[model samples]
Target: MVKSYHPETLEEALKILVETHCIPYAGGTDLMVRYRQGPGLVPNFDRPVMFIGHFPELTAISEKNGEFSIGACVPYRDIIRHPHTPEILRQACSLIGAPAIQNLGTMGGNICNASPAGDTLPPLSVLDATLTLRSVSGERKVSFLSFFTGPGKSILRDDELLTCIHFRLPHFTVEGYRKVGTRKANALSKIAFAGFMLKEKDMLSDVRIALGAVAPTIVRSRELENRLIGQPVAELAELMPDLLKSYGKLIQPITDQRSDANYRKTVSLRLIKNFVLKEES
Candidate 1:
């Protein structure tokens, strides 16, 4: 039988995490599905489980010093409804799943799960979020961009608990998120894109683009973005084809059950093109 621990406080949770090296359980939406035997049944566990979803410290959302700090256990529904939540993130959260799932699922869980197709990842990537990880020893911050090593993988240690995710507030002329999936809701993305741009007198100054479900992890290219920044908005349409071609070379999608590589590639570029055009208008 698997042992279970429920800690009321984050400090207690970190102690449990370091001492027992148990699996952190928050929301358990993905974990349960991965361990499920069948319908109307609980997942069988082979290791100790630490339930940390309801800890008060991990459920708050606050803003300070031009940064928005969201607790690891803040549910998707809460983020979607929170007045201070970034619009791009709120939009992503609103599309995650059905209402019940949204109410139970969390941003930290989503980040820790590290699914390449995770709905929230692209937006987080574009936002340049950072994660605060706490262990009995101390706390450390990890850039969201470098957190994921591959699909369903992250640099998080067994003794560490992700406490919060935060990012500087973005100022963009236009921001967009697009996810191509089988259905509008309750479906995994085939190809997803999130983009934001800062324009000064019709010249792009800051441009960020993040693509999901197209690689081992969420993909962002500073090199490619540099090529577009400081360029006139009027030149964007003429430059799009080459940009898409360059992105196509970098994004190596596979033929998975959810989607084929060709389709994912085609749709990914189309979405990028549409995003640029929308910003141009």
Candidate 2:
């Protein structure tokens, strides 16, 4: 028999999650579709489910001293509307489904889903995000870059709940985000790319680039970005070929339902090249 739990508090929810073998339920935008059992039929819940979507502890959004903390269960709609949300993140959230899915989908769910094509992952990666995972034992923060192990896989334990995400927007003046998909609305990304740059006195100080749906994980190479730091922004054009080659070597996109490997890689590199070498505006 299957069981369901709706804990009144986040603590109770964490307790139940640890005490029972169950899946954490939130938004259910992905779980419902994944466990669907046919029209009008209850989705199959093989073990148990503990509902945490309504916990206020997992739905707040706030910023302090330029650092922002977003509750794990915050819906995309709220993130899209939050004033302090980075423009890249806000734009990615707005592109996520129609208003309906945005209203129901949470960024925590998106991270936990660990889909390579998730539109928000690229932005989160380049933003240098951190995830807070909690359980009855305690909570710990992990870098967004280290959270996922593979497609639909993450280090999140059954006993743990993702509580919030934290990140500081770097003092970057140039930022870009792009998502390629079959359709403009409610479409999953074929390839997602995000880049950020900070320049001072014609010299590059920071550069971050993340590519999604093109690898086992969202691809980001701080090593590569660091190599370009201190170089004059105008020189990026001279380094385009080598830079794209390095980025191309980093991404391992696969041919799947939405796109081919070659196309994903080519388009992603093109986006990066454009971001770095385009004329200043």
Provide the overall lDDT of each model, using Cα atoms, as 2-decimal numbers: 0.89, 0.89
Consecutive 10-residue window with the lowest summed lDDT within model 1: 272-281
- List, residue by residue over 1-281, the lDDT tens digit for candidate 2: 55889999999898888888689978889999999999989898788987788988899999999999999999999999998999999999999978999999999999999998888899999989999999899999999989999999999988899999999966787888888888989789998889888888999888899988999988999888987899998787888888888888888899978899999888888888888875545
Instruction: Give the TM-score (vs. native) of candidate 2.
Output: 0.97
Error of 1 at 161 (Å): 0.7
**How close to the true structure is residue 74 of candidate 1, measured as C-alpha lDDT?**
90
Q: Lowest-lDDT window of 10 residues in candidate 2?
A: 272-281
RMSD of each: 1.3, 1.2
Candidate 1 regions exceeding 4 Å error are none
> TM-scores of all models?
0.96, 0.97
What is the alpha-carbon lDDT of model 1 when measured against the actual structure?
Answer: 0.89
For candidate 1, write residues 60-144 as lDDT tens digits. 9999888899999999988998888888899889889889899899989899999999989999999999999988899899899
Could you tell me the TM-score of candidate 1? 0.96
